[model samples]
Target: MTADERMAAARASGPPAPGERPSIAPAGRLGSLLVSSGQTAVGADGRLIAEGRVGAEIDLAEARRCAWQCTLNVLDAVRADVGGLERIASTVRLTVYVAGVPEFTDQHLVADAATECLLRVLGPEVGRHARAAIGVAALPTGSPVEVEAVFELA
Candidate 1:
């Protein structure tokens, strides 16, 4: 499907609710760079896709799905800011935060979900980027994962 088609499908599946606006700036221009605010795994229903800490209240697979959801939210924010995903030149960076127990060492695997989603949506060339996977004690709204990105405009 085309980017527009994918976006429409996502909206139809339920996101942003009716008349709901983004809680953050979404994306901001810093010279030629576009930086997005951190996005959590909140679903269209306004609840975290996966909650609690990985290795305790949540599992790796669920954490990965949460990360993917966060990635989608980032894409929505980027699209809203730039008018089109086609305007994205390259994904400069991705920072994924996984809420998990200190013993959890699979944070990178959780982050891979976001990377995979970007590759699928934006293609390899533009999706390839520097990334960091971090493990934290907690996340906003009890979400298991959150993602933030920086992109350059085409």
Candidate 2:
């Protein structure tokens, strides 16, 4: 799906639960770059889509889905910040955080879900970017995953 299509779908799905603010500035402009705050796997219902640590209460598959949800939240924030996704030139950086138990080393794989969603909605050239996947002891709101990004404005 294109970014517009993805945005339309998210709108049709409905806004997040009322009164729940984004964890940080959805997106902010610093010169030509748009820096996005970290987003968790919050659903439209205003609930964490997946909770607990990977390799523990949350499995890889579910964590991957949560990663995708976080990506959508990021996109929503980007749209609100830039006028439209068309104004985005290309992704500059992506950072994925996975709450995981000790010895859980597949953090990069979990992060791929967010990258895949970006590519699917924004196209390959624009979505491709440098990335880092981190494993952490815990995450905010108990979410299994969180995603943050930076993009260049066209």
Candidate 3:
């Protein structure tokens, strides 16, 4: 969606409850996160950018399916929050966190599921940023995967 449309849509969705915040705070110093955890809108240089989450206990699946669902939902939430797909400036970065068992060291391979999903949704622009796939004991909503993005506004 265009930045304006996305912003407007984001304003409409309001924000998720504070308790619903995803544990997306990657270890980095990005000048204080623009939005807090679980927040659908984030501010960067005063610009309000929006993101969304999708998943509940009912959405969980095996690793591969979970990964695909996560990426799709991330884009779905983005589109819903932002509006249409014609206004995106760039995808700055994406971080995917998966809840897996101790033997799930294959986290990177599973992460590919998310990247592929983004490629289909965002096209070549998906190649513009760095990414990471991490394994954890649990996700905010017990989801198998939770994806988040950093976007550049037009």
Question: Where is the poorest 10-residue window by lDDT in model 1?
Answer: 15-24
Q: CA lDDT, every prediction?
A: 0.93, 0.93, 0.55
Model 3 scores worst on lDDT over the 10 consecutive residues at 33-42
TM-score winner between 2 and 3, please give it.
2
TM-scores, each model vs. reference? 0.84, 0.84, 0.58
Over 4 Å off, model 1: 1-23
The sequence of per-residue lDDT tens digits that candidate 1 reaches over residues 28-130 is 8998799988999999998887779999999999999999999999999999998999999999999999999999999999999999999999999999999
Q: What is the lDDT of candidate 2?
A: 0.93
Candidate 1 overall lDDT versus native: 0.93
**What is the C-alpha lDDT profile of model 3 across 22-94, one tens digit per residue?**
5554222234222112221223333222221223222223555666665555555555545654445666777
Q: Which model is ahead, 1 or 3, in terms of TM-score? A: 1
lDDT of 2 by residue, 2-93 (tens): 99999999989887897877566677899999989899999999999878999999998999999999999999999998889998899999
